[model samples]
Target chain A: MTIRTTLSAGLAAMSLTATLGASTALADPVTVGLITTLSGGGAGLGVDIRDGFQLALSMSGSDAIHLVVEDDAQRPEQAVQIADRMIQSERAQILTGIVWSNLAMAVVPSATAQDVIYVSPNAGPSQLAGAGCTPNYFNAAYQNDTMHEASGAYANVLGYENTFIMAPNYPAGIDALTGFKRYFEGSLAGELFTQLGQTDFAAEIAQIRASGADSIFIFEPGGMGISFMRQYAQSGIDLPIISAAFSFSQDVLPAVGDSALGVINTAEWSPDMDNAANQAFVAGFQEAYGRLPSVYAAQAFDSANLILSALAAADINDLPAFRTAMRAADFDSVRGAFRFGNNQHPIQNYYAREVVSVDGVLTNRMVGTAFEDHQDVYATDCAME
Target chain B: MTAALFLEQVLNGLQLGLMLFLMSAGLTLVFGVMGLINLAHGSLYMIGAFFCAAAAAASGNFWLGLIAGTAAAAAAGALIEVTVLRRLYDRDHLDQVLATFALILVLSELTKIGFGPFPLFLDVPPILSGTVNLGIAHYPLYRLALIGFGLAVALGLWLLIARTRLGIRIRAGENDREMIAALGVNIRALYTLVFALGAGLAGLAGALVGAVQSVQVGMGEPVLILAFVVIVIGGIGSIKGAMVGALMVGVIDTMGRFLLPRLFGHFMEQSQAAGIGAALASMLIYVLMAAVLVIRPKGLFPAHA
Candidate 1:
């Protein structure tokens, strides 16, 4: 995997200087512009995405592809600027590698409007799944609410009578709580929304201790997750924490350590998941990156493979053929048995994962399937042709 | 809220304040003595955390890691002062700001290279890992220790500034750099020492806090912002002001988060209340800062006055 990545890096470097007309000699080389949060708070997720995407490209040994990567810095305006540059200057036919829902909302509309194929590896905002869905856009990841919704259902399965749900006060956070409440059969003991990038959780912890909630479902991802889990553990509150995989995946669990042990999270993929595509992606990612692949990496690997399969079927310059090929979703996904809904979002299974101490290191292992072949509820609202 | 819960919240506020104090002390001192707006102060805090996490993991001893982290940060601070900052002592604040901001980017990237993009865990030492019975609420022993340690540092700092020769020199240097230099004090050495001292405080705070939070890249920027607020509210050059400002900011922030939602819940739906409450809670500190600015433009405890 490392050797392949190195070779791809060499190819990518060579392509940087390679003129537009140079690649047209054989066939029109597809330029994929990947704009994601490569710096700031949630950089780990973006890094994983890029690595996963590159790994798949390298493994496929595709020469008819040119990858252009840029950092969005987790800002909407910056993402817009990058999207414009990629579309107008880089002549990228397909745009991917958006990590956050808000940034995706900002860039996807404009990119798809201009006839660029927007394939999302992550950040499946509900709007895109519903009324905002476009024929030019395909979400290789699950909808924004799917994981949280599944976790809420799993909480019911665990017989939780009263659960406290908390998330940051952003669009994603609102979606998280709304999703959790949709399938959560239990009475909500409390609903809390914290400041984005908030590092302290003492006040919230104190409140949760008093609220008498049987379970806590928190959607604080990345650094926020690390702080909350550590503080929650320090607070000596032992309530079961059911979470979305954004906070509990391999990217975050190492930092969360023992505090996150025994916690359950819901996601579309895990490293230890049993499947051929998943096994290859996980092993390849580990060998390349020397770390366990998070679900972000798994989804990104799938996205790249989707692109490859689509490219194999049709030329990127031919919009109708490319769209049809992409719609077919011929790629073998790490999540297994994947297909796109009418809305172009994934119809995939969500799994329950438990954070356990494996060989003295914190990692998530698949516990059970939460929702089988779960198609997002918002897909019905999409009127895309 | 129950008395125990309130007490715990207050303690949490103090713990937060003390952590801010550690960060602000270095920044305030640097500004007061050198008239430099060093934005890279947060990078030093991050350096401490990464060092602490790495050392702790390598040594399997938290104490050794803490010492190493603090010392490394101080050394790095001293090195930067000698190499880069000494040249900027005579430059304007804007130049200092730009240079320091660049330093922040460099340090953050370098730290990311040394440590991977992922966060590192710093476990709470076994002795500080349990809970203490506070009658109505059980508080974490680790947090209590953090507050206690911060207080000790504050007292020690007060003594160092008020009682020690170096402290007197620092204060004197703050008052009149030319006079101190004319009086035979090596201004360059004093500046280096003070810079190193400030870095050590920031580093110590980072090491302590890293146990409670994940040690990751860009961890220091938020704390650095709060520390700036601390110094601004406290009066930039004053240690007493930093302490007061930190406590005030900490309590207000914490209590706002805890009480605001409940306050809004009386008038609206829970979800709406949560959304509005959280929005207001985040803005509470800045509102306090604005109010304070309106009342006293120079801050509550001006070091000079």
Candidate 2:
């Protein structure tokens, strides 16, 4: 009787454990945790990267990345919470997608500490581009200061005497101002750093109106840009409102409508760039979402391109090689040329652009070159020997 | 600065104040009556704006879309109250916060799934497209109309609460829900009505502001927080207080942003003055809020049933 009972217990244990584990292990897909600001003011950018990443993944015909999505809600604490769950509980092998620098900073350190690789589709903060740069961290987008520095250089070429500089007050805002000052050596009529995500700019506009500046350079992106531009136009300030890449996002232009026309911005790429890559990307994006792709979307696409190349180079079956290959910056980006700076930040050209209304469709088109081989200034200060 | 410039800035303040009133009213009322701190309130505002834009573009009539947007928000508010919020009413505030926070996630993703994450604009009607003269100041006619419309709403809400049986029930509920329920009132129905009313107000606010601003996802959130700040300063659960608080907050925020830096310029460098003043001005509302909290924890004009 004892022998028979032991045999039954052994059979039951096998039934409950070994066979089940074998089947489950081979069937479940490798999950990638895509953390983003899927809600709040940053939702537009989150969705852009979402669509672009999804499209690029589909085009690659690889089932290697099974996304376990979490919306950070544009909160730093929530992003860390989501990252913890994704890493330990959801068992997401790789992490990607963050639109804001503050949030990326919150999540990346945690992910890196766990020895998990994080791929940033956008938001390469200078600190990340410099000293805090990690081997496990690779960014597929432009560094935060690169484009703004380019804008400042172009404003210098335009030869404006009295210029005004404005940015949302934060680390990135300060970075933008620092970057702008690196290239723009002219006298600043006034420097106004306002609160982040401020919807109304009446007070700031009042300040600008009184500054008596010849040119106005600003770094308010997404919905904030629309609010500022609309209010600026209505105030009849009559100065050129310059911007970083964000003023011309697919998220902002529609809000301003005709008010956005003639606004000059600076970026590496625009939908109306008239390049083969730009035209193709714009066409594909419009066909899918029925709207032009913003710079964020373009970066997302570039991220996918880089990721795919890295995956192929590493031979996905080998995770170590995949990490090694990603460290190498495998593919050429959509922006004509790109190379990883010593700190792994991107070195790329920047273009000055204008929003034009052609046949009722409004988008930014490249008007002039701003800076070439433009490196973020803080890279020189980085002690990443 | 010239008087004309100052006059123009004042006009801009009024425009901003009116927009704040639209958002703050519903929020103040929701807090006052329902006694629930809802973070997802902004998501409902976004839903209204999105529906207004889509419907207006489809039907080619802005007015009809505005109506639909109101109804849709009412329906959504009722639905959320019934399905999710009802369960949370008796729970801890933290539970309600967490659950509603989750609701924001659901609503935002659903919006992306439905509207595909693109920002849209609602056009000002042709009749109100141009600027109108106001004491040597040119104002956008649409903006003026918004102020008129907000005043009408304030008046309408006043009459609805003061002159109607529903208002009595709401007041009664705010005073003592158990008493109202024991007195044979259909408390569930009353809650539904209040929730729907608050939601409709929020929707109307979103749609109205949609004309001047972009109708985009999550657009309602920043304004929603400010509205809470408004009610807190004015006194919770009082419509009159909401109106007063909103206008006060708006006017102070606008005027301080404009005037404070100049005031500082007398002693400091122009750039230093602007910087110091701008930083201080941003905090002025919070400072006012803290002072209010010190004086009246319940609010400035606490509602007595």
Candidate 3:
């Protein structure tokens, strides 16, 4: 009776191992946690990122990846809490989709420390790219300063000498101005640091007028940009404005109305980019969400495809192999020709796009290239162990 | 700064002050008459902007949108007074605060659901689209119109409060609610009327500002904080105090933002000075409020005293 029982137990164990081996041969499931701002002033950006990522995921038709999403409401503390819950309870091995730089600063360090992979779709604060860089972290978006640097480079191209510059007083805001000044060859007419979340720009506009600047370079994003553009238009101080795409992106151009027309802005991706991958992304995104995708959405789509490409090559359980796959970044990016630098941030092209009315719908068209194969200045500072 | 620049800054200050008065007037009136701290005043302001944007898009007339917004806010005020605020009159301030805070959440979510998460476009009317020659500076005609509208509303409010029979009952209720009830006056209806009137004024301010600023969710709370400061400085429940306090706060805030950075620039690098100046300027209004509170604990124009 004992010999018969041992033989039956061995048979059952063999069947269980066979089933596990077959499953491994087929595909290994990956859980991804997406924490983004979904219910506040910044909700528009988050919604675009979420819809873009979901569109990429659904198009891939790979049931191997499971996604869990939560709203951070644009708060750092809330983002931290969500990251904790996703890591511990949901067991999300991969995390992505943070919109604001401040919130990313709060969540990314500890998350990477816990051995979880964080592929940033947006919000690449300079700290993560420099000495604080981690091995497991990858930035699918440009560093925070890179877009602003593009504007600075384009400003030189446009011969904007004695330009008046303004930004809100915060870490990212400071980075924006610093980045612009790094590449700008001309002297500044005026530099003003306005209060964050300031809606009224009348005082600043008056200062700009009195500054005798030839052009204006502002970095006010979201609704602040809408307010500034409207007020600036009414003030009749049209000195040819240039800014990063954060202010002039598709998500905000509609609210900005005719005032945004002909404005030159710098970005890594535009809807009018002439590439098969980009055209497909723009068409698929609009058909799926009924609105043009912003640069944030394009970045998020790339981040998801990046993950999928890595997953297809290596199992998530094999951490070293998966990291190597992600580093390779073997995927067709909507922005075209995307790859990671030594710091794991994207080294790509930045273009200057002009806001134009396309069939009465406001969108951007590529006008010029700002930077070719641009890498972040801080890449040399990253001592990745 | 040049004289033209200074004049432009002053006009900017006046415009900001007048808008604050419109917001503070309603807040003060409700507090004085009902003895209820209505924290949801900002939510009403948001509702006004949303309704105005929607109505303006449908009608293509800013005037129609303005009327629709004002009426909607008044109606919302009346409904809220009858349903939720009536029971809270005798309750503690904490309970009133909690309930009204909840209303903010509910109203904000409902607005988001109705308007989606994006800001709506609302441009200045054609007649008020260009700049006006103000001798020293060319100012936006819509802003000058806003100043004129705000002043007209102030005058109208003063006449209504000082001359009308309804105003007499409102003053009486503020002094002695029990006495007004004993004098065969319908206190419940008066409360609703005052609340609705206050709400209408707030709505008007919101609709006007929405054309200049982005018409989006959570726009009201920042303005609401400044309104509270204005009332506290002017003395709660006093419309005259609200007017004086609003103007002072607005001018100080605008001037602080304009001058503080330049002041620091004389001693420090321009960029460093500008940063420090802006940091201090944001604190200027709160500093002014604290100073006022220290000197006049009851406020500049306390209704009771």
Candidate 4:
């Protein structure tokens, strides 16, 4: 299995670098390493992110950048090792493409400490936005709590009095609930946390049926969400559910089928958004990949554009100029207007999306904006000193 | 907390145990009869789920899909037994492990190629979709039916292995493989039959559970791990042990997650209770397995002994 994955990754890297190797007019090639989970439970997320970034790379048509992609297998230790290899052997000046927060936490701090610019396409852990922020680190995506906080705000809008909030028993899960509580005005009937990647939610379903909660907010991601939604629907629990986009996105909607209908989730981007950049991206992505892009894809595409624009603005030898150009956010983001906050995270809008049948398939449709021109609350904690 | 809730939980435990039993029974049978460690068993489970989901979508009949799924898994198992597994029979357990592990990768990749890298949906049949009022609490009719079906299969398996001539041959074969061969029994054919039967059971479990879980690649590995634990606790190579061990693991796991937090809540803050309780609940099964191993290293029912 390891050999097959390594061989495929090597082939992909070779093909990409071979194309860029032709543009040898530049003095020193700017190498970028993408370390993301690509072989395990949530591999779909990484695959989408990689595809989106690669789409951007091909579109940029620049021969100056050399891309090296590797799978971290969703392990923190593995991510750290990949980051080290990317820095030491690959000599990559820019790093991106981590899908999980735990992996980001392990890779970002250490990689940035060594002067490599870490552009996160997904997974904006709270620490990276707060006191632990660094000048070398930039989150082109929304903060980790953006969706959960938006869910909380939307739950208040929907007037759910007594809510039950549940998440996996991990740091990200705690951050999710904390963000939800920050805006939710209603009383919580119960709070629960299950094991990460738990396939069965039978006991948890029983508790939800009995909790008397008017609604539920769940943050189980990837396969965990699929299992929870299926079992929850099977258990005949019809309580209204609000959730983060991590669980209810387009990538997971098909697997869940009718079980996810009427469920609402929060996200920073949707494929149906109206804008020139977004329209081009959606059409190009669909034409190239034959599938609608997820929010993860959109964020990754934007991260790639941000890097490309920075590269266009400054030469590789000038570090200060490159950082300044990146901060300018001069690229046309798929999500209309975009800017970086003091903490290097995006200041963008969060939308409340309901799972609706689009073209005979389950997908999310934007209903309303939860946070317009939203920025992470932790931006104040970042000093950049 | 209430008797009704406890009853519902018990029913849920039974459903889970039965599912595990379906997977473990086949695993133990294959191990006992062949002495070959087959990690690709989970791949068979995945195949069953994928076939069931595809057939259900194509035919729009869940029952037909279930049959097709089980039959396909059996066919696949028999094919592997004849072509690949037969070679590993004489090899050491380590060789068997490596070869079977490689098979898992091959099967999973092939499934991904055939089905695409997306999860397929399988709906519960209409007849079992609704709820049943179990005196104090309402439960899903499908879950209740699943429990009944699993128990029936267990009984049928017991009868097949205990009453029939094939059962006698199987028992004798487990005791002494060479003696059975010298007695003019077609040991090769028997091994293939046993392996196919086991694969079919695993497939049935996958098809049954697919309705309640997303049918996707690698979905079988977690259930496979739990089934291993069940066999170890029940005493490996013993059908009855698999049943008992599955139920014990199921009930303990369910009750632990449901009750541990409440138990802790009585003495501490709710948040603290929830955190610590969930942590302990996740480890409860491993703790039970350790206790079982300490008491009976051969498991609760060693078929050979």
Q: Write the per-residue lDDT of candidate 4 for residues B1-305, one digit (tens) a residue.
A: 67867888898888899999999999999999889888889888988988999999999999998998899889899999999999999999999999999988788778877887667889899989978887788998988999999999999999999999999988888889999999999999999999999999999999989888878778888888899899999988999999999999999999999999889989997767888889999999899999999999989998777
| Cα RMSD, each candidate | 6.6, 4.8, 2.8, 6.6
* TM-score computed on alpha carbons, candidate 1: 0.95
**Alpha carbon deviation, residue A248, candidate 3 (Å):** 0.8
Q: For residues B146-168, what per-residue lDDT tens digits would candidate 3 score against the true structure? A: 88999999999999999999999
For model 4, what is the C-alpha lDDT against the true structure?
Answer: 0.89
* Candidate 1, B206-304: lDDT as tens digits: 999999887988999999999999889989898999999999998999999989999999999999999999999999999999889889899999878
Q: Per-residue lDDT for A1-385 in model 2, tens only?
A: 6999999999999888988985775565556788887765578888888877776777667765687778888899999999999989987767888898999998998798787878888888877877787777777777888878888888887787788998876678777877888789789888877777787776677667777899998988777777677656655557876778787766677767887788778888777665665566677887888777778888887777777777666654466687778767766566767666766667778898898887787878789899888777666766653
Considering every candidate listed, which one attains the maximal DockQ?
3
Give the lDDT of residue B91 in candidate 2: 88
DockQ of each: 0.74, 0.37, 0.76, 0.59
Ranking by DockQ: 3, 1, 4, 2
**In terms of TM-score, which candidate is stronger, 2 or 4?**
4
> Each candidate's TM vs. the true structure?
0.95, 0.85, 0.96, 0.93
Question: Distance (Å) between predicted and true CA of A293, model 2?
Answer: 2.3
Worst lDDT run of 10 residues, candidate 1 chain A, spans A19-28
Residue B157 lDDT in model 4?
97
